[model samples]
Target: MKKQKIEISLEVFETISELPKDIQELMNKAQQARENAYAPYSRFRVGTALQLASGEIVLGSNQENAAYPSGLCAERVAVFSAGANFPNQTITSLAITVRSENHEISEAIAPCGACRQSLAEYEQKQKSPIAIYFMGETGEIIKVASVMDLLPLGFDAKYL
Candidate 1:
C-alpha cells in the first residue's frame, strides 16, 4: 500500500470586513440568526446562511432537543431547507457563525461530519462547488472553496 496525504486550502480573514460585500452581508445575517438559536442545553448557538443561484438567501439557527441526536446543526438545517424550497436552484455559497455560553470564540468553526455529508450530496447534485464561509463568535472568518474539501472520500449517491 502507498501512503497518501490530503490537504485543504482556505482563505483566512482576520475580520469579516475583508470578505466581499455580499459575503460580508451573509455573514452578518448568520450572526443575527445566532441570537435566535434554541440551544438551551449546550448554550452553543450556531447559525447558517445559504446563497442560492436565484439570488435568494436562506437562514437557519440551531435547534436543540432534549434528545441530542434529534437536533440538527445550523448548516444542515439551512442546506436542507434550500434543497426543499429551491429544488432547481443550486447553492452558491454558505456562511456559518457560532456563539458559546462562556465567551465568544475567536477561532473559526467548521461543519460537523453529518453536515459535511449533506453538503457533499448537494455539491454532487449541482455538479458545482459551493463556497463555505465560517466565522467564530468573535468574528474571524475562513473561506473554503468547496464542500468536498471538508469531507474527503465522502459517501454520495454515486456509491449507491
Candidate 2:
C-alpha cells in the first residue's frame, strides 16, 4: 500500500482589516451573528456569512436543539438559506466566526466534517471556488481558497 500526503494552503491575516474590504465586511457580519446564536447547550456560538455573486450577503448562526442531531450548523444554515432564496446565484465567499460565553475563542475553528461535505456540494453546484475565511477567538484570520481544501476527495452528486 502506498501512503499519500495532502497539503492545504491558507493565509493568515493579523487583523480583519488586512482582508479585502468585502471579506472584512462579511467577517464583521459573522461576528454580529455570533452574538445572536442560540447555543445554550454548547455555549459555543458560531456565525457564518455567505456572499452571493449578486453582492448580497446572508448570515446564519448555530441553532441548537435538545435533540442534538436536529439542529444545524451555521455554515449549512447559511448555505441552505442561500440555496432556497437565490438558487441561481453563486456563492462567492464564506466567512465564519465563533465565540463562547460571550468571548471570542483565540483559535481558528474550521467547519466540522459534515459541514465541510455540505459546503462541497454547493461548490460543485456553483462550479466556482468559494473562498472561506475563519478566525480563532483571537489572533489572525485564516483564509482558505476553497471549500474543497477543507474536504478533499469530497463525495457529491457526481458519484451517484
Candidate 3:
C-alpha cells in the first residue's frame, strides 16, 4: 500500500484591520448580513458575503424554519443568489462569519460539509478558485486560497 499526504496553507489575521481593504470590506458586509439572520432555534447566526468579478458583492444570512432541516446556510444562500442573478459572472472571493447568542466565540469557523459541497460546484462552474475568509464573532480571521483547501477531496459532477 502507498500513502499520500495533502496539505493546505491558511493565513491568520489578528484583527480585521490586518486584512486588505477589499477583504476587510467583505468581512464587514458579512457582519452586517449576520445581524439579519433568523436563528431562533440554534441561536447560531451565520453570514456570508461573496464578491463577483464584476465587483458586485452579494450577502446572505442563515435562515431557520420550524422544520428540522428546512433551513439553509448563509454560504449556500449567497452563492445561489449570485448564481441565479449573475449566471455569467465569476465569483472571486467569499467571507463568512458567525455570531452565537449563548456564548462568546473567538475562533474562526469553516463552512459545513453541505455548504462546502455547494461552494465546490460554483468553483467548478467558474473554472477558477474562490478565496474564502471566515471568522467567529471576534478574534482572529482565517483565509483559504480556495474552497478546495477546505474540502480537499470534495465531490463534484465529474464523479458522476
Candidate 4:
C-alpha cells in the first residue's frame, strides 16, 4: 500500500473583528440563530448562516427531537432552506458557531461528519466553492475555502 496524505489550507482569525465586515455580520447572525436553537436534550446549540450570491442571508439553528435521529443539524437546515428558497442563487459563504450550556466553549467547533457530507453535496451541485467559517462561543475562528476541505474524500454523485 502506498502512503498518502491529505491536507487543507485554513485561515485563522484571532477575533471576530479581524474578519471582513460581511463575515463579522454573518457570525453575529449565526450567534443569534444559535440562541434560538432547540437543543434541550444535548444542551449544545449550533447555528449556521449562509450567504447567497443574491445578497440574501439564510439562517438555521439546530432542532433536536426526543428521538434524536429525527433531529436536523443547523448546516443541513440552512442549506435546505437556501435550496428551497433560492434555487438559482449560489452560496458564497457560510458561518457556523456553537454554544454549550454546560460550559464556556472557547475552541473552534467544526461541523460533524454528517454535516460535512451534506455540505459536500451542496458544494458539488453548485460547481463552486463555498467558504466555511467556524468557531465556538469565543476564541479563534477558522475558515476553509470549501466543504471539501473538511470532507476530502467525500462521496458524491460521481460515485453513484
Candidate 5:
C-alpha cells in the first residue's frame, strides 16, 4: 500500500471591495438572505447565494428547527432551490456568509460536512467546478476554486 495526500489553495481578500463585480453582487445577496434566517436556536445566521450558468442568482438562508437534525444549512438550501427551479442550469459560483449573535465573526465560515458532500455531488453531476466565496460577519473573504477543494475524496456514484 501507498500513502497519498491532497492539497488545496484559496485566496484571501482584504475586503469585499477587492472581489469582482459579479462576485460582489452575489455576496451582497447572501448577506441579504442572512437577515431572513430563522435561527433563533443557534442565533448564528448563515446565508448562501448561488450563481447559475444562466446568470441567475439564487439565495438561501439557514433554517433551524427545534428538532435540530431537521435543520438545513444555507448552502444545501440554496443548492436544493437551484436544483428545483433550474435543473438544467449548472451552478458556477457560490457565496456564503455568516453572522454571529452577540459577537462579530472574525474568520471565514466553511460549509459543514453534509453541505460539502451535497456540493461535491453537484460538482460531479455538472462535470465542472463550483467556485466558493466564504466570509465572516466582520473580517476578510476567502475564495476556493472548487467545492472539491472543501471535500476531497468525497463519495460519489462511482462507489456504487
Candidate 6:
C-alpha cells in the first residue's frame, strides 16, 4: 500500500475587521441571524449568511426540534433557501458563526459533516469555489476557499 496525505489550506484572520468590508458585513449579518436561532434544546446557536452572484445576501439560523433529528443546521438552511429562491444565482461566499448559551468558543467553528457534504454539492453545481468564513469564539475568522476542500472524496452526480 502507498502512503498518502490530504492537506488543506485555510486563511486566518485576527478579527472580523481584518477581512474585506463585504466579508465584515457578512459576518455581522451572520451574528444577527444567530440572535434569532431557535435552539431551545441545545442552546447552541448558529448562523449562516450566503452571498450570491447577484450580490444578494441570504441569512439563516439554526432551528431545533424536540425530536432532535427534526432540527436543521444554519448552513443547510441558508444554502437550501438560496437554491429555492435564487436557482440561477451562484453562491460565492458564506459566513458562519456559533455561540453557546453557557460558554465561549476558543477556536473557529466548523460546519458538521452533513453540512460539508451539502455544501460540496453546491460547489459542484456551480462549478466554482465557495469561500467559507468561519468565525471563532473570540471574533477571529478562518476562511476556506471551497467546501470540496473540507469534504474530500465527497459524493457527486458522477458517482451515481
The model with the greatest lDDT is: 3
Q: Which ranges in model 3 have alpha carbons more than 4 Å from their true place?
A: none
State the TM-score for model 5. 0.97
Q: What TM-score goes with each of the models?
A: 0.97, 0.96, 0.98, 0.98, 0.97, 0.97
lDDT of each: 0.91, 0.92, 0.96, 0.95, 0.95, 0.93
Who is ahead in TM-score, 2 or 6?
Answer: 6
Report the lDDT tens digits of candidate 3 across residue range 51-126: 9999999999999999959999999999999999999999999999999999989999999999999999999999
In the range 1-65, model 6's lDDT, one tens digit per residue, is 99989999999999889999999999999989998999999999999999998899999999999
Candidate 6, superposed: residue stretches over 4 Å from native: none
lDDT (10s digit) by residue, model 5, range 52-97 = 9999999999999999999999999999999999999999999999
Which residue pairs collide, candidate 6? none
Range of the 10 consecutive residues with the lowest summed lDDT in candidate 5: 146-155
* Predicted candidate 2 versus true structure: per-residue lDDT over 1-160, tens digit per residue: 9999999999999999899999999999999988788899999999999999999999999999999999999999999999999999999999999888866588889999999998988999889999999986667899999999998878888679
In model 3, the clashing pairs are none
Model 3 residue 20 CA deviation (Å) reads 0.6
Higher-TM-score candidate of 2 and 4: 4
Q: What lDDT does candidate 2 reach at residue 140?
A: 82
Q: After superposition, how far is residue 53 of candidate 2 from its true place, in Å?
A: 0.7
Report, for all candidates in order, the number of backbone clashes: 0, 7, 0, 0, 0, 0
Model 5 segments more than 4 A misplaced: none
